[model samples]
Target: MQKVASKRWKLAEKIPPEIEQALSYYPAFFRQVLYNRGITSTEQAMAFLSPGEDFHDPMMLLNMAGVVERLLYAIDHHEPIAVYGDYDVDGVSATALLVETIQLLGGNVTAYIPNRFEEGYGLNIEALGHLREQGIRLVLTVDCGIRSLQEAEHARQIGLDLIISDHHHPLDEIPPANFVICPKQNGDEYPEKNLAGVGVAYKIAQALLRQRRKELPREGFGLDLVALGTVADVVPLTGENRLLVRAGLKELRRGGRTGLRSLAQAARLNLGALSTSDIGFGLAPRLNAAGRLESALASYQLLLERDIQQIGMLVQHLDDQNRERQKITTEMQKRAEELIQEEGFEEILFAFDESFNPGVVGLVAGKLTESYYRPAVVGHINGEYVRASCRSIPAFHITQALDACADLMVHHGGHALAAGFTIHRDRLAELKQRLAKIAFEQLGDLDLRPVLRADVEIPLGELHPEFLKYLYLLEPTGMDNPEVFFVSRNVRTSNARAIGADGKHLKFLVTDGWITYDAVAFRQGHWMEAGLPKEVDILYRFEMNTFNGRESLQLNVVDIKPAGGD
Candidate 1:
């Protein structure tokens, strides 16, 4: 029901006639899309479309040889190894993969996921002591431990061999783990640096499996966990990450993983028709709920569990927890908006709640950043120290910004747009001032307006059943590699109806003289009150809709404006 205003619709460059003639396999609109995405050549297009035969070599990763050697020795000797992981979905999937892969190779391993509320993120001294008490001779961390410089040293002093495999941005000082296997630390020309925790774990799995056998077992064996982590982490869905998801989706559709099958059933998802969106929207959140509300070990166990009744119970718990997570986030968002207003709407927003769930702080920050188009810092107001989640727009690198003020924080790690840290409550104001100054220096002069980039401007008639098939070629779309967008002009709306609870969405029948199409606009129910103008220009994604076993084309309208507006 909320209509966005002041959005900038940027159209893709027009393709020349000669180029279009040569790219007959590509629809004219999609040709521009490929070009915009840096796929200007036929070979580039071919490679993007068909990622076949090869993936990046695991040995090419930094310290991979060391990781493999250390891990192989642990496996052969049957040393008790603790798989340390964070609490998010990326960490959950990576933990599951590492545990299963180690078990498959006849290794002694146990999963150790820190509680979000208790242990917080990454390695802690208390956990190390407990692991040592449990006779953990070696610690293999997935998706975390990159920034645990102190804890890594403590593990060494306590006579535990530590191997860290994480994908987060490294601080200036790397942890003293036995071998840190992250590509970014190499400073070499690796093909892809955007592998999520699970992707990194998958590479380790591939190397271990190939080391143990002559030929690889299967094309995409056990990739469902990899895909779930890759997609859920919101990593760039290009390069090697694309290959992983593309293969993983096939495995997911096969219904081979009992836990995933039970989860899909609980979420009312059809594995046969599973897409990346299903994983992102339905499955990932539930998997993430285990970490956000409770121990991530629950989700980790769900991934490896084969018993039907246990899986059913886990799925039910995850579903319920996900619902509770949603409710908590909604209330937090409301409080965050109020905090924004109280702060007088500064350049960088700071929001905190004494009662806010520390786990959903990132979600709140993400929502606030998207809603206001500014960097948001959402903190869980602990008594003296606070755990804060920061989300930023494309213009600012949040982790880099955190690096600028690293001296003030207990610890921090993340990527460009999202990061987290712990700081004392007393320094909150100074932290705000420091970050605000940096944001002003970097982004104050910019437009700060949200822009929707379109692949091409095409008539509504161009979208047909055939076009959906072409769109199928671009699967597993997410961050970095986005879904296609179209700018359709002179669209006439025949009728408009407000749908959803309390009329929060707009359903319309639109035509551009040549084609009449069904359209759905999310959060635009306000348009129905004005009866929708006779003519308009709409920015939308051409979507294939299915209902009652029938397929048809519909426009998923993103933004609408007057027909002649700039």
Candidate 2:
């Protein structure tokens, strides 16, 4: 690891007086973090700390006018409309939100979530032909169809009207849909650009809500679905997104939706105090497991169903599926690592096997990318074609790299960080060479070491119960506004020992000259080389760890470096 020089924290010069005043309400160390993140003005800080739905204007999104107009026309004519969506949490939730919104608007609508194993992602031409045969006059796609140029043409050829509401990064050419509500579309002026797929669907719902002049249902109508999609899609939780998720989580905890309540019950989570972490780590993976292991339609049906017993049954099945997914993912990860070791890939790693499940390749690729901090691609040889998923670090854009090899791909689309594609089985080796060339060119002369961003630095003496209490104001942290990580130098370890049953976790008591604090380093067994240091520089986040009816402030250790001479 490269060593960074120690320097005193300097607040940004452009910090406004109001922000300084707000800093008076916080510790000086935290104030430094606010300044570093460009939250130097009181207005900016307040907005960042407390976001609301008012931050976004639905009208600002491109194609909103056209989408709303066409939807209203469909409602007026009572056209038979199909809500076509992908199978993941975002796709399912987007489909549920839009179907509910349109149904409330008196539109004849039915939802169709593509089967992961049979139909795959986005609009399949055969599915569109089937919908046409079913006499579906209009189709609205959510969370997909941004790059379905040929599929859209097929729909047009079959006399089916199509509207697309997607948030994926678009290619140079857009499909000829009646209206496209993708924020990435050309000339889109929406201020917030990084909306998840479900976020785009929520915007459409917002537009319809405004047009109808109806108050959002106070009984927790759409927020559950919103929360599911926002968390699962891993969109930045800032601005409008933060507001939606905050409100949605509130509704989720209040027990507004049967599906959410059942899911929480099945997962053994406390519905009364649900947090973003719970949603991301606990619920999302379970919901996504169905799509990955079996049928994403199970998740979609669970969210939309009104029957309580049915919801419970589906939750049980999802829980089981999630356990299975964990097993499969673990095995795939081991195999992927072995492949990398055997291949000795220095800068980029590419692995494929006929035995690899197409559904889990994306997850395996993500794990490999994080493990090595390199551009990683995992694919499954599916008969004549190879379905692949690609994940990249912050320094690389995987989708753009895939686009460069567009001629070699049958279909592909995704964001800069993650993407997926398909190629003829015979072309796998050539595609791997092409991808490695692109990665080498783009990553040349760039440092590939992982960065753990510390929000602030403080003496261990400053960590107190009162200070940890004040930190609660920064709850529900994820994506853009992450949990605050503080670095403390020259901290002496009073005691350290393995804590967990399998010795996977490490517990320690650390102290400065004036004060002592409890700390826990999860999954740090491998890092416990030699004896624990008496004094170390610790990077950690303050969290409330509860166990055995005890609630106390704890340092969640991120990284530890040997302390220099005091």
Candidate 3:
């Protein structure tokens, strides 16, 4: 893990007196965290703390006017419209959101989510042909079609109009669509650029609302779908994204959608108190597991259905698929580890197996990259080609590197952090060599260690329900605006014991000079036998733990290090 530089508290430098006074209710350390994250001015602090405000104008997004005009035309003309989306949680939720939005507007609409294994990502030619045959006049793509230059061209050839509302990084040449609403597109003027796929779809929904002069739905009912996809896609939760998720989470807690309620029940989540962590870890995974292990249609159906019985059945199927996905992901991770060990990859790691499922390769590759903090690629070998998922550390841009080696790839596009590509199976070795060389050259002198950024340093005595409540102001935390992690130094573990079913969790009591606290570290059970020292530095987040009808405070350990060591 990366070692963060220690610094004195600097809240006074950033926070205004009024904001600081308002935060006086919180512990000094919690106030410092709020200040450090730029919630310093009165308005900024208030907005961050409240989260109900800070919405962006839907018209601010690029192509909102064009998209709205076209959609209105389609509604007025009674044209058959199709919503094309990708298959992940973000894509499925985006599809559900757009389909429902258009249906509410009285437009004849159908939805399409590409099959991961059969059709791959983006616009598939066969699917487009099928849609054309179904007399779909306008194609509005959600979460995909940004890179489908040829597919879009084919649609144009067939006299079908297309509009793209995607968040993926665009290639050098964009497809000729009727309208495009990607923030990252060159020359676009959207203020919040780093939107998730669902975020873009939500913008489209917002545009429709404005066109009709409709009141923003009560408590943002549409936001529940937005929250699921925004969190699931792991987009940075800052700016407009934070606002959308905050509202969406509120809707989710109130049980806005029956489909979401059914899904939460299937996942055994307590909806009343659901947090971003629960959605990202529990619900999103089950939704995504269907796309990985089986058909994504199940997940889409679960989200779009109104029938409680059908929702229950679909949730059960997804639950089973999630279990199977876990098993396959574990097996794939083991095999990837073995391949890394056998091949002795030093600066980069790449693995391929014909039997590996393409849908799960990305998950496995991500795990491998996290395990080693190296750029890793996991691919599924086919007859003459290989499709792979590439995950990189913050220091490397995998997609740009793939772009550099475009000569060897069939097609590739993604963000700087994660990407996907296809290459001739015969040239897999060459592709790996080229990518490794690029990564090594670019990241040679960089510190590859992962840094755990502590929001603030806190004395154990300062932890309380009030402080925890202040921390709740940073709701819907992900990517950029993450849950605050505080570092406590020179603390001693009073007692430690292995807990949980498989003894894979560690529950411990820690004490500083003036305070004692309960702490739990999941997947750190092996540390129990490592012998706790008298003094250690621990990185942790404050959480409200409920057990047996009782509520108490707990420290969720993120990392631990020797007190005086680097």
* Number of the predicted model whose TM-score against the real structure is largest: 1
Q: Tell me model 1's lDDT, rounded to 2 decimals.
A: 0.86
| Superposed Cα deviation of residue 268, candidate 1 (Å) | 2.3
> Which runs of model 2 end up more than 4 angstroms from their true locations?
1-25, 499-501, 528-531
Query: What does candidate 1's lDDT look like per residue over 1-566, in tens digits?
Result: 12125699888777777766666678776787777787767777888887773788888887777788888899999999989988888888898888888888889999999998998999999999999999999998989988889999999999888999988878768898888887777463557899999999888887887787734345567688889999999999988899889888999999888899989988888788898999999999999998898888789889999898898899999999999999999999999888877876456888887988998999999998888888889999889999999999899999999999988888887888999999988887888889989998999789777899988888777766677765778887999889988888888997799999889999999997877999999988989886688899999988878776788788999999989988
TM-score of each: 0.96, 0.92, 0.93
Q: Worst ten-residue run, lDDT, model 2? A: 1-10
- Which candidate do you rate higher for lDDT, 1 or 3? 1
lDDT of 3 by residue, 1-566 (tens): 22122322211244566867877866667667777777655567676777665667778877789899999999989999999989999999999999988888889999888877888888988988999999999999999889889988999999989998899998878889888889999988888898889889988898897778765557575789999999998888888888888888888999878888988877778899898998988899999998887679999988878888888888889889898998999999889888877666666778899989998999998998777778889999988989999898878889899998888888888888889998898788888788878877987777666656777776777666677767776787888887888777889887788999778898988887678889998877877788767688888888889876688889999777778656
lDDT of 2 at 520: 92
Greater-lDDT candidate between 1 and 2:
1
Clashes in model 3: which pairs?
A: 2-450
Candidate 2 TM-score over all chains jointly:
0.92
Candidate number achieving the greatest lDDT relative to the actual structure? 1
Local accuracy by lDDT, each model: 0.86, 0.82, 0.83
Model 1: residues >4 Å from true position, as ranges? 1-4, 16-18, 21-25, 187-189, 214-219
